[model samples]
Target chain A: MILLLACVLWCVAFRCHEWLQSRNRTTFPMPVRAVWLNQGVRALAPCLALALCLMHSPALGVLFWLGLGSVCGVCTSVLMAVLKNKRGRAPAGKPPL
Target chain B: MRDTLRVHMGWLHSWLGFLAGLLLLCIFASGTLAVFDTEITHWMQPEVPLHTRTALTPAALNAAAQAVEASERQGFSTFLSLPSHRDPVLRVLHYDGYEFTGPALSPETGTSFAPRETAGGQFFYNFHFSLRGGDHPGVQLVTFLGLCLLVTLGSGLVIHLKALWPDLVLLRPFGPRPRAWVDAHLIAGVLFLPFILFMAYTGTAIHARVLLPAQSFFSPSPAGPPKKSAPKGRLLQAGPPLPPLAPLITQGRERLHSPDGNLVLFTADDVRIFRSDASGPFLTRDHADFSRKDGHFLRSVTRSSPTVATMQLVRGLHYARYAPLTLRWLYFLSGLAATALAGSGLVVFLMKRRRSSGENAFFRLAEALTLTVITGFPIATLGLFWANRCLPVALTGRIMAEIDLFFTLWTLFAIHALLLCLRRHAAAAWRQHLYCLALAGGMLPLVDLLSGSHPWGDGAMLFVTVDALAFLSGLIALFAAQHLRRPAT
Candidate 1:
């Protein structure tokens, strides 16, 4: 259950990081304060997850955080890509090939 | 200057990644499977009843000790392995060139059962590092490939350094085929960078001695002299009876501060009680040696030196023997991701070159090889399980037969792939192999059910887990095959 929580936190962190990027600003269309908030969450969530994990054992906690972080990152990336595709066609009105 | 550097790095990454990705696929896949080796072995040997919560008896240990002694008297070095949670049957095992093979003894009683000999999961464990080739050449090749993977990863990171962070979560599965492949390669590579780098470095460092013969780094002290071959046509005299192990086990566990002391290695001079690899994060060879004649505790040897501890940590990281179930699953998933990283790189390599060199013979061969590796290995792996079920239980030398079937199936797939490629039907080969893989994986559970060898009682979970994973693999393969039916973008 703690691993699950850590994984979800990692996913949120990755998503926030994705949204805060300058290149994604046009697509995300967030307010400046909201962007700042996302950046804070992106930084704080991972640290919170790491702390939660370290409550277990330092060695295993670190391993779990890294492994879960990578897997959750991939999941978030794939999920975002799917959502982006469903939102519309590619840029310039071109359909996805 | 930066453009030129990127160009050079891109070329190196592409060519080196393609060359090493082929064998690395097999290594990573097999290594992933090896994480569950004991469970897989349990699945393979359904005849051995799972003795969950069964306490280890002195009789069982002595019986296994006797078996080990018998094998040693016959000049084969063997060890007595105590029952553990993952594997509840005490075993007397000897290295049969490829894997440990022996009789399983009841943990409660001293009765021994002859489980049908199959390669079992140890085949994957051995093949992961040794490639089933002996230590020298196989370890050398794998070590070299590990270096290549490191270099390729370095170059790839350099090429993508600019976009690494911003494109961290960029994947477009519905985009152009080439674009999608690129996204997949980059995403998987970047997300799995830590795991891939850790595994490659630790794995290569563990075998660095093979690459550099002059440097001796933390070699463990041998229990005794090197083993001698068994004498032919000679009746060997039995050695002295082993002392009761129950008390010794208690003493050893107390001394080592490890309740998981699960292996008792017998040498001509003494018996060493070794802490289980699952005991902790350190793969320490800390053991208590006892005199063979009297079973009196001689000395406890613990590798506490900084250098030895560091090496053990490296090995433990790579082997993951210390991981719990959840962590083990994480290792397995991360390993699969690494395999996918290599596999996607292979696909991208082929796809990128297909338009320009589709007519070239070398390109065709590369496609055939890639198909053989990516699809062929899973097919053979599933076939091994099939062979375990289909082969007669009473047949002699069935272990060899099972291994033969594994290789034979892979070779035949290679031939099938080559023929398809020669006929300019490389895409068809991919579809066909995926279908075959789907069939092999989808039907594994049914085959296990029908074989009647599976234990549906105490140990059914192991069998169920293997079947479920195989079926899941089949579903993925089936999906891939159906996806391939669409025209190429």
Candidate 2:
């Protein structure tokens, strides 16, 4: 269960931009759809992680895992930004293309 | 009012959050540490031998009851606490007008253990509420700031609500300073909005009881004139007859239907045995009251009522007494994010003003004070740990000495940062203090190992968590110091 949750979370988290970028305006004219999709995955990944915790941990443990998963996702995103920047691949200090 | 609604909300978020942000940082930071206050207290006082998970024996209860009586004769109002999963030592504690001060005992022999006299983790816990001021004044200030936080949070959402979805996972830390800070702040603010709002609301609600006038909350006239209050918690003359605690424990357990019942409060007339609710994950106010005189079962008190249970739940959420280790860590992490939210908001406030308004005295002063509070607090906290490790155990008021070191070091560092800022050495100040934080926080384990009273060599992971966390925190600070802001080009 933990491994499945991790796989799902990592897939949704690291590939979030790809999910966004793949949304061509022709099929999804409203930007809200892409935004909703991004938000859904980000939100769902934590819930999935917490669902896994609920199998073994108590309710509060599940709540903690939920919060932990979200914060870790954000922190990992930040770390990825820095690492990408260090590798000279990030388009920092400029608006998104 | 500002020209536009968004502009006005932005202004409100910046000023209100910035003004209260410093206090919030300390409040939240201290509170984060406080989530593990008891665990940290256990860690700081390493002399109290860890107990195997066992129920309290009747002999142990009698011994602790006698000890309580003896302490009461000395004018201390005492209560007995049985072993639980968190802190396994039996303890007899009294409110010293500041903290739970008393003796910890072994359940087998019921003899007291002499742990070191450090302020322990309660200092952070109390400081989180009152900032070490008298409880009334401190509570009022904290509440007012909490209200301000609510206002700031509301206005911040108004400004950033539109971008919440679009920028859900975007963080560009390597961007230019202002942009990076904005993105970072937005990400934290958006991601932890529920937690931020809940903490601010529930925390204030817990402290908001004082806001009501005494007359409003209580009946001015009761059914009868209040009976002359008995001299409560008084120790009886030696060998005063009392019922054995075993039956009460058994009965309480039978009534509550939870095996892990603990005798929390003891008095001449009655004793209270608290146990976690079977359906609830963590603990709640579910207990059975037993008469101490004859060990007769009194009515059980359960917070299953919606109104009473809700209030108790809010209190539980605030104090986190009900949390297991996992929930406690979640509370701790959310608290750190809340601190960062306050911190990055403050930095962006100054960065925007510095660029647009130019570096005036007010901006420089704010920057210095920000640097002082943000860096100085950790430095001070770590210094307290070092003082705990280094201070002579036999020294009178050794705990006070550790507390004094915290304040002294924090004040000195703040003043130094301020002076350096005045000399236009902001970058240097940040770098120096971050290095100091790394040093103070990193070297704690080695210091603990040298003290020989530590649990590091003893292979107890419970006690070593504190040292391990400090080392990790130090490493983060060292990494941050490496990336200290370059002077504005």
Candidate 3:
């Protein structure tokens, strides 16, 4: 459904954050690539959702985008929790971090 | 530099946002619920059998009119309304003070089902527009508040202009109270800006009739009581029989160019058939009139002027009666977000001044009011639903009793809130009130089940959807209450 797709888009945004945090940063702030990667996904989530909704109805698509935006916040919180847990656990053959 | 426009706008934003946000919170919350007003009414009155969602037939009009006539015999000035997409029940409604509550007549036959007298969904719809104040003041007052809300939003946006987009997605749930609430306010405000603006614009425009009575923005629709030549003497006696409905329906549809249109208005003289211009982007109330006595074609009412048509479009956008189910749900979600936006703004205001005004009596008073209005109103709303089922059916003034319960519960919560603030237990009061909201919302479905309504199995989707929604809201409230369980600083 649209809600799940929206959630996946949101989760994908958070996954970008996970990717950034998991990067091998020699210093505290991390490198430029990781920062862009996180910011890029965060920005793309909304535009992609808007684009998907706009294909259905041009006039009302904006409203749908708003609804999706609201849902994405809640979904991102939920999905981030799952992605965090997955990342927190060590790799399949490795021990816990 | 300290006295620049940004600082002035910030001052305006805080003052205006808090003041307007409180009232807007009530209006927004109730308005969101009012989207499914008919379904709520369906859940409230368990006696009436759910009819299939279909267009109201000509026979439904005859039945609705007959039911109105029966009420008229009792000295009640009544009107008939046929089913529409949002509310697919042909019912006869009579005004009680400023709200309408009456019997649901059968669509196939003219027989009226004597449902329990309750201040049904009309209570919320009426509350949104008039706040129970008649045409003179309530409508205009709500419109003024709406204008204030528009200004408040503008000021808030200007104050946050520099960082609006940069912090747009930021919401720090675990941060300090001010940071979290500021983030909430910002996210809700930025995301739902269009929804809030659209509703405020369209809602104020449609209700502007009260402030400026001369402007005929759309052809004024006659409602409530008969306005023209009907004699007042024999109104209770039912002087004449109604002409056949089928031929008039046919003529009205042919003239208006929509088969789904129905007779929304009827008197001894003229019957009006309302058709939504469905093919367009906006909804409309274009109708054709015919003589009720002989079924003669009277006039075709249309909003043709570009100005009036634009007004009609805004009006349609406000109610959104023409929207398909998906669009309606979309509107409903956006409306909920708007309500949340107003609510979060209130929390932000309270938390921002907490340190400076921690012991100030006026600050305490405002915080108490915020708690009472935001959480207490939902408790009162759920109380209204519960009262309808629990009150003795044979009790005198049962309908009034239900309405009284709503106001009485709200007042009691206000008193409770004020007492909590006086005792310096406002934080405790917030937590307790959230629990009350959780109980009120969570128990709604169970309450319906206990009342033998069968909300889940074998019940109509209207009843099922309402209960499921109430339960979902209850869970949300419970989650928030738990989120605030940590001891207050």
Candidate 4:
């Protein structure tokens, strides 16, 4: 039951994130090349957190996963913004292209 | 007036939550801990020996009641709670027309001993529902704050709606004003919105007895005495002597289909009633909670309304008692997040005031509030528990003494926080305050084990658990202090 709930929450959470980013496209830099490596690493965090917590306390595991997912998502998004700004080839904080 | 209402509600939510957030943070954190108040209480005082439940003989029960009644006749209402496996104490509670006191009565020996007035679990429970004061004004204030919370929640949602993705998928160590606030509010709010709404709505309704249509509906007019109905059946004249209540208890249990059900003998007469209603699940709010009111268990049923039942249901949901362990963990985590949201909101509001913004009256006020309630209250709470352990057992008026200890510590911390805030080093003040919190929290269990009559047995585990949680939280706050010290990257 928890697994199902977690999966559903993850799907909905990702979709919501996508929707919000779509609305504020100007300040956000486009993934210049579909950076799978960074996104994959970010996605692994929640999975690993869940796996580790499953042994000691499954409930704590859920919290760990959720927290890890939230942290990773924020870091990568900020990194994308900073990296794009540094390349100097990026568009000035434009109205969505 | 319409615009004023909108603007005031907006301002009310913003400032109330922003100013009260630190206190509310403590309230929420403590409240979540209160779910297992009794369990925690038992865990805290492990010295109370456990005994197997033997059959309740008429003689033993009668003796217990007689003892309780004698105690009650001194201008206090009294109760005798039967022993259960989880808690071996036969709970006896009485109000001496001025204050409430409870003592544990041993069913095996029919001897009563005053339990320590340690606010351990009840502190969290009482603080949330009644804010450590009695009902009425406290409930009213908390309800008012709940409305403001709703407003803050709505505005925070609006402000964070643009950055919801980063909130979900992002973790930034450094950020600009709006971005950090937006991210903090988004993650905190979205994740805990359901829990917060449930808590606020249910908390408001729990005291519906004092508010709205219920109060107006039930209140008698001041001009006249209540009009009485004509008597029915000559009021049953006089009937049988109280049939040795133990037999009636057995009969009532058989009828109720659950031996676990309790029996109440109203007035020790023929009007004996047995109740075994399911107080376990969704039925908790039912005034017919056969488990709670022993004497009037049956009579209360006819007078109850659907609204009362619905309100109780909300109360149960808000308290999260019937929830399974997994769901409880979810609620606890969500509660912590809610506290974070409230705390972060205050931090954001304070941060927005540039040093040049006229020394920002609001910023100074926020800093003061954060210090007093956020730091001071926890210190006071810790002290109250310490007093429970340290105070001599022969000490009288235990309840008032404990509460006084809490307020005294609170006042002291508030004064200290104010003095520190005056020094114009708000961040450093917070760090120092957190160190004090850590010291007090870390010492509570040790004090309990060392000072109390009871040894540091398995029973003290609750205190240990709470102490550990407090210490971890204090460490987290210390880390936060460090984070605050760094210049914005």
**Judged by DockQ, which candidate is best?**
1
- Tens-digit per-residue lDDT, B324-384, candidate 2: 6656777888898888898888888877777655457777788888997899999999998
| Candidate 1 structure quality by residue, lDDT tens digits, A1-97 | 7778888899999999888877566777799899889989998999999998888667789899888898999899888877767767332222222
Stronger candidate by TM-score (2 vs 3): 2
lDDT of 1 by residue, B1-489 (tens): 988999999999999999999999999999999999888888888888884547788877778777877787876777777777767778888877788889998888979867888889999998999898877799999999999999999999999999998888888788777788788888889988999999999999999889987646677767999876554322234446677878888888888877753788766567789988888888999999988788899999975899999999999988988898988998999999988988999999988888799999999999999998999999999999999999999889988999999999999999999999988999899999999999999999999999998558867777889999999999999999999999856
Report the candidate with higher lDDT, 2 versus 3: 2
Compose the digit string of candidate 2's lDDT tens values, residues A28-80. Answer: 24477767888678667756766666665655644555565556657666765
**List of chain A TM-scores, every candidate:** 0.86, 0.45, 0.54, 0.43
**Candidate 3 or 2, higher DockQ:** 2
Model 1 error, position B482 (Å): 1.0
Worst 10 residues of 2 chain B by lDDT: B230-239
Question: Would you list the clashing residue pairs of candidate 4?
Answer: A73-B169, A73-B170, A74-B169, A74-B170, A74-B171, A75-B170, A75-B171, B46-B459
Q: Against the correct fold, how does model 3 do in TM-score?
A: 0.84
- Candidate 2 colliding pairs: none
What is the Å distance of residue A53 in model 2 from its true position? 4.6
How do all models score by TM-score?
0.94, 0.86, 0.84, 0.73
What's model 3's lDDT at B483?
77
Flag the better candidate by lDDT, 1 or 2.
Answer: 1
Top-scoring candidate (TM-score): 1
Q: What is the DockQ of candidate 1?
A: 0.49
